[model samples]
Target: MTDPQNWAAPGANQPGAPYPPQGTPPPGAPQNPGYQNPGYQQPGSPYPGGQYPGAQYPGAQYPGAPGGPGTPPGPGAVAPKPGVIPLRPLGVGEILDGAIAYIRANPVATLGLAAIVVTITQLVEVPLGIFALGQLAGLTAAPGDPADPTAIAGVLVGSVAGSAVGALVSFVAITVLSGMLIAVLSQAVLGHKMSIGAAWAAVRSRIPGLVGLTLLIALLLVLVAGVGVVPLVVLAVMQANAAVVVLVGVLFVLLSWAVALFLGVSWALAAPAYVLEGVGVTAAMRRSFQLVRKQWWRVFGISLLGGIIAVIIGAILSLPFSFAADPMSDPIAGVSIVGLLITSVGTIVATTVTAPFSAGITGLLYFDQRIRREGLDIELARTAQQG
Candidate 1:
């Protein structure tokens, strides 16, 4: 009879070895003891098996199970990308592409979202104009003699009171509408349809912060105007652009343009940051400043692209209206009540269509930053699982 040790064993390194000697297992011998015969052991070796913790048993996989630790199912299958905006960090053009994709993916929702914002803005503008008109009327209707201090006081009081009341009323309405509109558009762009009430529910709690920031921004603009406009106008009257060019020339235009662009881009991202981050005005401004500081080119490119589109659409939409308003006035015709109403309506329609596309693009850009810097996708996954 053949020797027991010399009997051919499955997975043995040598054809005739039933088991390898002490401190050695055959090169292809079973790695786990239980899977091999129970008596399988090497003398003086306390540990019989070398399997690691959490390691799966051989030939024990359920049919169609995802094989191996941390491996997703199927050949060539990749795990899903986490987070709502799953696109990779985007450059300016890619962000615009994402925006266009959003519009294409949800045309009706995008339109509705944009409409809501545009309607509120345009409607508020109308009432604001009416209020301004009333203030102007009150100013004109003053009965007090110009020479009397008492009369001047009365006129000043009426003007001030009207101005304050008008501003307060208009601002409150716009603020409430803006918050509600943002919440709706945010969800809408994500392909979720929310009722007006639901959208309001999401944003009304943050209304005060939004309003305060709006007021602060308005104040900032007012301050900037006081510093820049009066001096610029005075200089312009004192010397024309060509004369200034002769003196400071191209430098003046360059400085003015640079300042304008810096301010414009700074303010551009501020509102979105406020709405999305729920940050206070100052914090939002700082955040925006930090984001755009090193990304000047990206910001400028996106802004230019959006601005060009807006200008082209504006020209197309306004041409007929401009002609309809009588194009031959020497001083140029004042705002026509009817024409203004029609134009405002058109603007609202256009805005409703475009706003979500822009908002989604902006929101996605914010997501990309957080994802790259904070492992935001992991947090988002946890949030989704919890939900």
Candidate 2:
């Protein structure tokens, strides 16, 4: 924090700096860090749930020193420690550690908000689950001895419709909450703090775009799956030759998978972009792609690692609750309301903890990417100084 007046945003005078600057680094910023924080923490998938929501999210807050980024910490030289993380490009351990630190640093905004959202999401799921399962169990054969196709179809349709509605509800609720959390992290990184109401207010206008971004990524994935499976399904229905079927299936699978992976990794930061950059869904996607395209593997690896940790931690934390719910949660035996409610409680406890951590890791990853690729530390420092 010494001699603040002379320090200039790195590359400020360079012809190609992202922004023009006349002064040195801001007073006390990590520089910039913290990305989107996916609010969901589901199972069987790494992202949104397993993605950043459940799978992975980015990192978090705290502040740094007032002086410039201090001699630009050389390789592992320990950059300015104004916040939860170092200002320079982050390492694998730093990213993970920062996530945990952030939760502790901003419990009310991070943990408190997460608990509220997960509680609501779980409570909502209980009724929807019972209704859907009940519809399936209620179907009986028509007047005829044989089962009625129409009745069966009706039940299936109803179940799908119900599930879709529930998903939409949970998605919107968690996505908004996650966005609010990111807003919290954005300030926290600058050594700032925010209340739950303040966090909500910061992100209120971006709700629509956040929801849209989630849906578009989902739609793209579904389309990729269809491309890989539709023809295989058709061949099976037609009783096509086994050899030809296998070959086509393998080729299609590989092609679709490649495309999906490219897009998925490239757009890993889209949620963060939407929240932080105030961009549309498509624009956010492009922003993430540009940010991630160069270090695709690194981004993918960090996200993968974050998702893995969240799953392991969530499983450990949730087990006791799951065991408690086991007696009442046996749906195969019957839709026991007690069991369903108990199960929901377990989910709430587990996700409440893991969701923010997941989001924080990915959000931090986003900050790391920007710092490395765009020298965002300078901009973040400036922002901090102004604030």
Candidate 3:
């Protein structure tokens, strides 16, 4: 495929003449006296000139553009403008459409994916619960002297080691679980599949890039905190005006958070691109940023909607536990063992339910951007036909 970025405008496509205004025919071009716009065809049918089966016009694809069965006229058609792939802005319907594609294309694999994810959650959650209990046990063990340097060093070492171990365990578990979910959903949405082992193998090859991005973001947050808090502490100690200092500090904090969010989302959005397109993480991220450049809000809105739905579902599931609180007790245990079990199960189910929708959006967004920026429709059709 040719690089759209490098491809000369229509003028270059047509030799020895100025490029026409994007859609207009060039000056003194063969003006057929009786010609009408080839793009003005009726919905769901071929263009008047009987163009390629999937040819799209500037505004949209011609009706019946050979998308999946039962796609509506709006999805089937292009947005507007020729020589450009239509970038369908992300929407709830688009997210659902991608999810449905995934399920329909790979039912067996999808179930396996759900089981894998939920199982990992259980594995981490159960062990982590016990670890927390152990930490509590340690802290209550014979309340040692606070001023003893030896005792303090031992406690500090133990605490840091425990926290580090827990963090490493959860990080690996989540990354592996999320990677599997993403690979499965990408296959599902693309109407393709590989064996479970093959899918795992594919993700393994990209582990370094994924792990690097994860650690990079983690370090960035730590640095931001250290920088911001240390200065604020110094300022407070020096008797500076607290309100002004805090406002300035808050602005920097917000800026840092925004940069981190953009970097994190861009990295995540490119995961499928890297795995499927054989692109490096950096290149994939560059590609994703380009794809989302014009439609950040649409993607953000879809994310917001998904988050809201997850929160609402989570809140409902959590209500029983909330009501189970033992207000009379000093510690006030929040739930019975049975209630805890139910809540854990509910949380796992919610995560499992929402995983595909989230993964599917990124996969679909990848496809949309690829199509628009790289003429991916042609390559996809060709790849499919060859297969």
Candidate 4:
């Protein structure tokens, strides 16, 4: 057979025999619109007439672009280095870790402030401890003497007074220290390092406010205890039925204790607010209550956890000293000056270490709550970047 290319139509084999004229348009057909040509351009051919996908046509910004006007950042797009915490809503573990990190990152500020306050607390406590021991020595009745209720009462009063004084002093000291550490932690969260002097200077003006808040809390607790105990005391003195008085007292104490604990957690962030926001005690209390409103249980749990941890560690540190001092025995007989001093040393060490951690946890928890309730992480991120 002939090759296909060499073959021709029967009519076309004759020269130009009625073949279709080159490039002739078919009858009644419109001229070619040139739509199929590669170089042809149409209206809005590059983009749709209305808008382009993912484009902000005139002055609009691309969604989620950093630092773009009218654009919000994408989720987790602004994460910076861990200064004190990852600037986001935090888990319980993260909060705890952040507290530890605060200590590690600014030991001179956190630990040094703790040590100074704890040392002052120890100084106040040691003298009281000695005075209490002396008072106990006098309260010991001679072997033949009947139990002297008056002398016994004197000893009880002395012990209680000594404890109250020591507690008050420690409260003031810790309040001051916590305010300073909070200032430090706030700066740390913004990726700034603060010297001890700087931290103190930042918080110095707020110390009086912190003290006032501390006193208010203490007074509330005392009132709660008094309300729970006064009825029982009255009934006992009036020779009421012992079982009745005990039962009523137990119920009252339990209820009051629960209320006190709830109130305590509600106001736990007051110090941070007072120091950081430069607010008054009443305003700080209100601010803390507002922050903790919907997250009361969470705040309570974290505060209780921190308190338990501090107590456990303090007990562990004091265990050896407790054994040496034998405080359970007669204060006059078993306790020695050296043993008392050693016990104080244990307390000082424990307080020095745990105080900062507890304070830091509170401050960070405040920040975490703010980040969740308000978009504080954005402000913090901006602050971090600026710094």
Candidate 5:
């Protein structure tokens, strides 16, 4: 697909028509046109047909800024900016900027959603964490004998249960937040504001599908991992040579990771697809696969960058807390209730800021893909006008 930025803009560089210089009408053109593009002039009244600086609020995009993703690609190159981003194929910077822009635009809705979810997750996690840490403390203490079987069992059970619960909570939280955030973005693109209640309501009906999508993705990952794990299990059962077992395990680990990465990137848009297109889980998965077709690396690169940014932000925000409190992940550090509470504060802060931002990037990527493949920008532009 052609980059929208490279699309030819007519009269942008015409001969004998030196620019009137922006923010000013041309030397000969009438004031009614009131500031056409820098190098070009509209034949009649400005913003002749669609979204333009002439039609929008003061300080909005100039007409002829650039065209959107696809279809009926016309002059005024940029259709308009009804919301966080222009109705056009987005740049990496624009996508990142728009994600932050939405958060600022509806702080209560975006940040509040994240905070509530994090609270729910912590309500479950903190107790389990404390229990697990207590078990570790018991095991580490001098019982003067080999550890009691029951005590060992408790440590194993508590650690396993805590890990499972945390993973499950994170999966559900990400899915739910991502779906709702996409709903928020859809409206934001049309220049509408949303309350937390509105954001929840928009995605309420799609909740089941969103959860199912997450589960499906998780199951696929496990299945792919099993491809590696099964061989190791078999090799061990047969009393395979240690060297062979290690080599096989290493190769399978790499293979599984590669396969998982491939599938993860391909399906990264499924949550956005489910919310925005109002599709079922299977349909959304298919839609994502379709959108990512022929663009695997592009989608992967964008997602990787977004994930990296979120990780960096979380680490920075949580680092001070880590130093102040015993790190929760380190059972050896001995989880103090105080430490847990302090860590919880940092976790909430980081997740609140990062979750919505990451989700926002995915949502915009979905829009970007739609704009490129299906002329979604045109549809969005029309919707903005009607609204």
Candidate 6:
């Protein structure tokens, strides 16, 4: 070396030092004794050197390691927006909100369906109601003397027949509407919009099954009530002991009502089950009963809450028309056709507004139960993501 102090290495210790102070590492090196580069995985890490834990290095699989090509998002990941309902298990509030959202999200399918069904129902019912009232008007024409028993009986019979006919028409209309709504809701839950025609197309084949299910449920309820009433009727007609007859009648009625309520709760999900699963009537009923087995109270509570809200809305909408139609206080003391028409209009409006929500909640409730019991949310999420 020419001079030891001046003979520094080729590029070191020049005008400005190219290297750090003695024992000081380079700029990219760890600054402290305990510091380790984020790019490096310390010992005990699941990754290899220079790979941090939970981080995907080159040629490494992602965290959570999804089992298949189209698995649903992991728990911490944000879920895709399914339609009205979220792609997750829902709370009661969510279910209610989802029901409302179904209407808002698919007004054409929901409102149009309700309108068509309600219009047809009103067409059949309004005339029958008017005719029934016209018949009853004769009974009240002369109010001074005791009305003839024969005429009174005839009026009652006519009223009953008209009511039966109206009820039958309403039943068919509602059943079809419900089937269509359920179909729409099923698609909506997957973030898909459906038209009235599309909803009908999806549900047309299932209408017969729905009808059969409704008829079966109705028959069951009728049989239950008859089981109680038939015995009481026979006893009363035979002039049996009044106390025994009353006691038996009360017990029978109570028993029948309890059975009906239990069955109703158990089969509450039948309509959606039938429409969505494409199961037969009996199979749908069985599926509903299975779904409700452990969640009976939850199903009952949700249904009761929805029903109460629907009843309140219906009452509120119909009240104005009821006051207008005040037959009891009318100067001309009989049902007014104008008032009846107004009331019918109010009913149609209310039904149009409320029926979709009723169907939506039931459809969503069916989904909620399936999620709780079958991990349906996972399937729904995967399907939503795929679409």
| RMSD each, Å | 19.5, 11.2, 10.3, 25.2, 11.8, 20.9
**How does each model score on TM-score?**
0.55, 0.76, 0.64, 0.72, 0.76, 0.76
Which pairs of residues clash in candidate 6, taking residues 3 or more apart in a chain or in different chains? none
Candidate 2 lDDT, tens digit per residue, 209-230?
7888888898898798669887
lDDT of each: 0.49, 0.67, 0.50, 0.69, 0.71, 0.71
Alpha-carbon shift of residue 297 in model 6 (angstroms) = 0.7
The order of the candidates by lDDT, greatest first, is 5, 6, 4, 2, 3, 1
Report the Cα lDDT for candidate 6: 0.71
Candidate 4, position 289, lDDT:
89
**Candidate 5 segments whose C-alpha is farther than 4 A from its true place:** 1-76, 138-146, 232-252, 327-333
Weakest ten-residue segment in model 3 by summed lDDT:
13-22
lDDT of 2 at 67: 26
Q: Select the stronger candidate by TM-score from 2 and 6.
A: 2
Model 3 spans > 4 angstroms off: 1-92, 104-107, 134-164, 221-234, 314-343
Writing each residue's lDDT as its tens digit, candidate 1 over 209-321 gives: 77887778777765554454454566667876766535563455456556756765666556555665556677767766655666666666776776666567656665665
Of candidate 6, the 10-residue stretch with the lowest lDDT total is 1-10
Q: Against the true structure, candidate 1 has what lDDT? A: 0.49
Show the lowest summed lDDT stretch of 10 residues, model 1.
14-23
The better candidate by TM-score, 1 or 4, is: 4
Report the Cα lDDT for candidate 3: 0.50
Off by over 4 Å in 1: 1-85, 91-93, 100-110, 113-117, 120-193, 218-260, 263-267, 317-337, 381-387
Candidate 3, 78-185: lDDT as tens digits: 532121112233346756566556655665555466556666666666555545445444555555634556655676676577667756765665566556656665
Off by over 4 Å in 2: 1-77, 133-154, 233-239, 329-335, 385-387
| Of 1 and 5, the candidate ranking higher by lDDT | 5
lDDT (Cα, tens digit) per residue for candidate 4, span 313-379: 8888778877876755564445766778888888877887898889878998888776665445544
What are the per-residue Cα lDDT tens digits for candidate 6 across 4-37?
1121111122221111111222234334543221
Clashes of 4: 0
Minimal lDDT window, size 10, model 4: 33-42
